[model samples]
Target: MSIILFIILLLFLIGQQVFFEVFQILCYTDFRLIRNEESEMAFDGIVVANLAYELKEKLINGRISKIAQPETDELLLTVKSASGQYRLLISADASLPLLYLTDTNKPSPMTAPNFCMLLRKHISGGRIVDIYQPGLERIIHFKIEHLDELGDLCRKELIIEIMGKHSNIIFCSEDGKIIDSIKHVSAQMSSVREVLPGRDYFVPDTMSKADPLTVSFEEFSSHLTRKPMPVSKAIYTSFTGISPVTAEEICSLAEMDSSIAAKEYSEDLLLHLYTQFSIYLSAVKEHTFTPVIYFNGSEPKEFAALPLSHFSNYMPKEFSSISQVLETYYATRNQLTRIRQKSADLRHVVQTALERNRKKYDLQLRQLKDTESRDKYKVYGELINTYGYNVAPGEKKLEALNYYTNEIVSIPLDPVRTPQENAQRYFAKYNKQKRTFEALTVLCKETAEEISYLESVQTALDIALTENDLAEIKEELTNSGYIRRRYTKKKVKIKNKPLHYISSDGFHIYVGKNNLQNDQLTFHFAVGNDWWFHAKQAPGSHVIVRTNGAELPDTTFEEAARLAAYYSSMRGSDKVEIDYVEKKQVKKPGGGKPGFVVYYTNYSMVIDSNISQIRLCAD
Candidate 1:
């Protein structure tokens, strides 16, 4: 079975013995989409405790200067303190709830969300009094002190729950009465909890798990064997803050197989597991977190508050803060999700147009081949006219000699037609074939151009890293008639520019993200003395190198060629041929496609599409 299905089935069976809320770490459908594998990255109780310490140290006495809800379940809070201004991002999204200090900010709606407005009214400039975590549960309580409507001092709780789907940001009174939450869960939505205004606020303890820090060894072994499940599942299910990965780590430290049944473990094995669990508990108590991200190859595999010994196979990168670990680990994932969603529609549009144009191109080529014998029909007509005087009244054949090639030719004739009629028939056939060949030639070129243009758009989408890049690509497709334009009074201003890189030799290299940028880079931005590089006979970006009135270096040329190849459809090829020429030699066609250009004399080289050594200008 597939890993996703296996996880689903495993969790489903465990759900009978475990509460759905505690084990929600495994069952979110969107979590499967977040990573190709079962991601060991988690936001469990240990992480919450580490975050609690960081938040208390960083945010105590800080004033909430601004609040915005960029997404319905997300909050961006800018806090000002003696330390410095910091932005705290919190998400109550079910599938992937998160909390971190980030350098990036998202755009908010013109009209704020209702929960955002409520928080602004209650604690817009409130000072954070305390940041606490209740045991090891995935919840953070931010106690903010502010002046009420009557100018009286008051304290309120801004609790963020990192429970999947059940995750929420709750605004509550000092006495634990719920004011409002980012998400409402009534009896119909969830019988276990009701998170509505006027309702009492409390974290549900449906799992009734033992505290790993306080529980005795006998108690741990007794609670674990109660459920006949894997040792890893039993450990996580028996403890409040433990995730499956943490449980596996504990088992690995004990030199035990996590997949073995908890009921099968002997007393000695249980004691070994208990000792390892105590070590983790002691680490959490002493705050000895390494705060590192584990990378499998170049992709982030897992992140943790403590050192993960089993993940030693993966390269570990330590961070100064847990928030930095979270931010760094999710950075690539965030970009991928954002770009994927933005480019999905464009991919469909480009692919549909490509399929249609390719079909038309094939049909056009077939029809053009049928007209290949147009000259032969013309020869037949001439030969018949020259030899028609010898024809009988009902002749079925016409033989002629002394043709252009000096060879005898036989022409089939209509038996009941006269010589004049036969000549007219052959001449009509020749004229029709000649016209078809001429029309199909132009049609085939147009169809081929359309296919190439669409393919270039696809390549652009493939290499696009930012929403601005996708915006340019989408605009190109919309203007090219593959997508319909939505008539709006105000056009969204695009700040997209070509990707700028500096060669190892210190030359400036610019790569166009799409066809429009290609046009802008070539005809408008580049000077006549600059160098242009592109993948030969393939759909790709136009790479321009600025000479600045100096002699060109070979390294810059090769670096620019690498960029051209990396951003092309032929990027997977081991060696792609790149055509480079001086900007003066490249000419834009009168009304060709956006990226279409004609150049006669150009230099060609075969190079691999490895741009890792290339550096981009930070600006």
Candidate 2:
């Protein structure tokens, strides 16, 4: 029986396409999914609730010392308390709303926005007397105490609602009258509520879902059974603030198949589920947060405030605080999703330019091929000049000895013209063809180079992990005339830098992430003795190794080559050919594009595009 079970499991793994390291290998005794689908590292009620409790513990009486509106939908606040000064970031971006305590700061506009000015006026020096979440809904309410214009103590409410595209940050009076909001929703936009000034503040009804926190046993089972969907879907949809992943987790803890319909659940199954749900509900009431991030190999899969035993097949990494988990998960996810959204326009421009150049390059190559017969015209001219004098008048053909090939040749005669005129005509045709071939030779080379440069820009977009990287690529395109520059009063300073890696042998290797950075590293940062590595005949970053006048070990050389291969357009190949030479040997041509260089000689090696073994610099 054990051997038969092992065979079934092996077959399932092959069909799933997931690696053995992930949870796809995990199966129940009856072969049902413990969790049907893996969700994105989520920001749900559990995250918000855990965060509220953490804030309640840490920021009970913290005074708001400084406030700045960084993005239009975001705020950075500095709070000082008996504990220490901390920075909190709250963003209501429709696509990705988040609230977290951060250590970094963003640049604000020279002129404060209207909503920012209003917040400063009302709550600039307010003390956070209480921080709480009403239920499991994605909302946090801050009861702030401050002095009014007449120096009388007053109470105000600052609420942040993280409801995806409906997210908003609203300031309200003590009686729940809306004072102002960052994003206004009028009757025309949403029929549910109006969020303008003087309007009452209230959370939109969530399809009349029950609040899991205060629900009785009878309410839990009756509400869940009334739904006509899968048990997981019914659970989250029937309750406030609970997410689908959490619902599935509750079912897994109950040892029940979440794929089963809630309407089909028996009385005994309902009791088992309620027992599990109450256990987690009790944990929330007690404020027991065991935050952890689950990883599928090197990539983060999901995170939760409580331990998720259903994802036991995945690698769980526990963190000390929910703040740490939020920071780590979102930063990594932001690199994958947010940065792509931010750089979409830049990517579109690069893609359009690449398509145009590629078409032009293909057409030029075909035109260049038609000029191959130019040499044949030259041969015809020579043959006519050698033997046409002996041809009779109005003759059609002349058979003569061709000295070029040491063989007999037949030359056709235009009967209307003399032999000499025919030869001259052939010479003229040869000259025109020669001129076209010469012009096309140069044009093809230039067109090919333009295509290569555009491809390199495309690769840079894929490598970009932050806004700064996109800015550098955008600047390069503007200078190259691919994109028109947008006028802005403020000249935003770009602080883009190259990726630094430490070689296994302790040598420092720097890889440029974009064309401008590549130019800067190759021309200004690297010394004559430093070494440069690039993918041979490919569009790639310039990898510079700071040798410090010492000989590099073999390990360092291979690692540098791997960096070059990984950042290039040919990163998909099992092995990439790399060219490495001293920085002094690499030279930029006059009037060349950014990152375009010429090297006379170099050493070559074939290396794979794997740098997982390399250590990135802390900075």
Candidate 3:
């Protein structure tokens, strides 16, 4: 049992890992699709600048045709190309790097959101003049030439922030005076330029590095060891506009493990690493590399010229670029999301039921052990009562008794009790254990059956696809009175059925699943002249016979007993007593629970589930 439980827990943990991996992949894909990067690393300002240079030669006076907020921190600008015919969507979202042509609209607040209003006011009819980046920093500036209120041509700068966690849009005047920003930072918040009206705004100072796209082989190797770090860490931390993701990619191309220390490499190996790095930079500069690569898994282990890990089996052997990784990641994540959405509640219920059953079994185990010891006292008493006077006190210990034969030749007394007293004590113990055994027979059977029923319910819930299926189950619960219906003025009518069965005598019967159904079955649906049944002192279904004026046969009585057993927690047990009486004798309890009722002059019989012997009515 413990092993089984441990395996269950392990499976759950693995499931969680899979879910998270899928979620990460979806996030990456969404980001890439919205941002529109040719390659994974193209999300930053440097890559954008390279592309901007190409687009600028063709687009000098394109007008902004559309503006949208695809995400909270992202913007999409549809601009007419310089050719005056083609429309291009340039997206700038730091989280994603791929540009996509998506036809979706964002919902606006009753009052326009700050970013919406800012974009609407400044760039609604602005004409694009040029796009530029400040060096290779992760920032893009769009120069827009527009007509002012006086119809005079003016240039306004729109800064697209691409830095992680600080991505935003800032609209500035030609004089560099901050007009307003999508996100504002006061001087108190940061000593860097305050992005509010009247304050001068400038880009944050970024660290510089020899562009990996243009670094010499000697320069790359020397700069790498200047810091005592892992080669992966050194390249990522020292590079500007280069993400850790890109640095890891670089190491993969070099075929050197990122886990290894930079200083551990021999001179020959260092030369080889530098050569690989140089070749990767040249590939990017020449646009010779593919834009996308797919991994068996979502993450790309390789980048520009680096391997992200010493271990690589989980990595795909052939991803040409990072964009493909994003696509595959999202696809897998979407699948997981759908699966999780379908099974979330049922999974929780199964886990909860398993925990409940484990605890119940443990309790039963302890009780069984206790009962075993108590039963010995009963055996001892019975033996002594029959023949204690003829033997010595020590002679009739437990070892001397033959209980199976029901004979004791000579039984002795306990030193603490006289022979008569000892015999009576043992006899009393024996009788008590017999009674307890009878009661436990029922209790254990009921508990086990309940566990079984709950497990079946869980199974049913797991595969349920439509709301109607859930509604049907919920209807059963409501009829059983597990949940109460609210009284409304609209006079809602319930369209549920009573549980139907046919006795061996061919008499039809009905049972109620809940308190509401109980009342409806016993008082409204039941013929007062028929028989009714219920489990004494327990929660169970209300059972009724539809005999009209016919007398119920013994077989019918027992058939009803089986149903009483099945509906109660005692279902499937060896036996159960079902209290049956004329339906007329049944009366609703005053101020009692919905299904709670009282009955008089009832008969009872023990019966097993064997419901197959009883006929069931169709819907």
Structural similarity to truth (TM-score) of each candidate: 0.61, 0.59, 0.52
Error of 3 at 572 (Å): 39
Residue lDDT tens for model 1, 200-314: 9887889999888789998998998888899999999989989988998999899899988988989988988899899887988887777988764234678889888887655
Rank the candidate models, highest TM-score first: 1, 2, 3
lDDT of each: 0.87, 0.85, 0.62
Stretch of 10 with least lDDT, candidate 2: 28-37
Models ranked on lDDT: 1, 2, 3
Candidate 2 lDDT over residue span 453-477, tens digit each: 9888988988887888888889899
At residue 470, give the lDDT of candidate 3. Answer: 49
Q: Model 1, 271: alpha-carbon shift in Å?
A: 17
Residue pair clashes in candidate 1: 94-165
Residue 151, candidate 3: C-alpha displacement in angstroms = 3.8
